[model samples]
Target: MGEKLKLYGFNNLTKALSFNIYDVCYAKTAREQKDYIDYIDEQYNAERLTGILTTLTDMIGATVLNIARQDYEPQGASVTLLIAEDSMLPRSQTQLAHLDKSHVTVHTYPEYHPETCIATFRVDIDVATCGEITPLSTLDYLIGSFDSDIITMDYRVRGFTRDVNGKKLFLDHPVTSIQDYINPEILRRYDAVDINVYAASLFHTRMMIKEPDLQNYLFKTDIYELPPLTRLEIMNNLRREMIEIFNGRNIY
Candidate 1:
C-alpha cells in the first residue's frame, strides 16, 4: 500500500467515472446485420461481462459484496456489482455495513440502420466509489476490453474529506484529465481531446480511432471483393459514421 493520509475520520469523498464505447461495422444485408447483432450478444453476454467486472473489482482493490446480472430479450445485457472498500470484511457483513455504496455497472445497446446496412454496438459503464478507491485507475483496462472504435469518458470528484488538521480536501488524488490514465501506446492509435474544469473537479475526454483499417470495419465481407468505386463508398460511409458519433450529432 502507498503512504496513508491522516484523516479526521473515514474519507467521504466520492469519485465517479463514466465510460462510453462504440464499435462500428458495415453489413450489406439484413441477414448479415442480424448475424452481427447475434455476434455482439454472444461476445458480450452477461457471463462474460460479469467476469470482466470481477476482474475490475480486483484491480481497484475492492471486494464484491453482491452481484445482480441479466440478459435482456431481443438483445443487450447488464451487470452490476456492489463493492466495499475493505477487502478483508466478511462478504455477508460488508453488505450490511454499507461502508461505501461503491458499484460497477455495464449496459449494452446494439442497433442497425434500416436502409444503410450500418451497424453499431455501444457499451456504457459507470464505476463509482467513495473513500480511497479511484475509478481512474481502471480506465485503460476498460478501454482495452472492448472493440473501442470511439470512446467518451467523464470523471468527477465530489464531496469533501477532512484531514487530521481539520483542513477539508475536496479531492484526495490529483487528476487533470482522463487521458492521463490511458496508456501512451493506446493513445497513439487514436485522436484524443480533453475538456476539464479544474475548479469544479470535472474531467472529460473523447477519443476516435485514427486511420481505421477498412477491412476491420466490414462484417461478412472483404473490401477487395468490391469494385474500386464501391470500396471507396464503403470507406467513406464508415468514417462518416465514426465522425458523427464522435461529434455526438448526425451528418446530413
Candidate 2:
C-alpha cells in the first residue's frame, strides 16, 4: 500500500511513515549543492530534484505544486470541505437546522435537554438569508418524505402532487433514532472547551464517517434507499465500527 499510494499530504505522509517499506527524507537545498550528496531512499524524500520534471514530479509527490509558496497559508482556515463544480446536494445539517417550518422545523434544542452542551453549541446554526431561495443558494426545506398520517414537523416542497388544498402529501421518513441525528459542530465545541476530556474520546473524529455525503452517498452507498429497519441496524453497526476503529488505533 505504501509503495502504491505515492501520496504526499501530511496525513498521507504520516500514514506512509506507519509502514516500514517506504523510505523518507528531506530534500537538499542549493547550499548542499557545493558538496552535492543525494539521498538514497527512493520511497520518501523529494528533498532534492535534479530538473524541472523531477521538481514537478516531486510536487505531485507532495500533493500540490501549482500554487506559489507565498500564496499558500494552510493555517489561514481552520476547516473547509470540498465542493463539486455543479452540485445540488441536500441541505447540509448546519443549513437544515436553521430552516423555518414549512414541515420539519424540529428544534436543535431537543425537548428535555434544551440546556445541554448540544443545544448551546447549536447557537452557531443561526444564519442570515434574503428570506427566499436564491441562485447558488437554497432555502432549506425538508427534503425527506412526509407521511400525511403522521404529523411531520419537517416541511418540504418535494412531496406535493398538487397544492390545490395547500396541504402537501408526504411519505414519512421520521428520524429513526435520536442519537443518529448527532451534530458535528457540537462535538467540535465540546473539544474546544477541554483538551483532556476531548482527547479521551474517539467519538467526534470517527463520527464523520456516519455523516451524509448527499449525492455521492445516494449514488455509491445508497444508504438512504435501505429499508428503515435495515438502516437503523446499519447505523448502529457503523457506530460500533467507528468506536472500535478508534479504539484499535490506541492499542500499543
lDDT value, residue 70 of candidate 2: 14
Off by over 4 Å in 2: 1-16, 19-221, 249-252
Give the alpha carbon lDDT tens digit for every residue of 10-89 in model 1: 46788899999999999888899999999999999999999999999999998999999999989999999998886232
Q: Assess candidate 2 and give its lDDT.
A: 0.20
Candidate 2 TM-score to native: 0.19
**Cα lDDT computed for each candidate against the true fold:** 0.87, 0.20
- Residue pairs with backbone overlap in model 1: none
Candidate 2 residue-wise lDDT, 33-138, digit = tens: 2111221211111221112212222322222212211111211111111111111223433121112211101111111111210100010011111112211111
Model 1 poorest ten-residue lDDT run? 89-98
Q: What is the lDDT of candidate 1?
A: 0.87
TM-score of each model, paired residue for residue? 0.92, 0.19
Candidate 2, run of 10 with poorest lDDT: 12-21
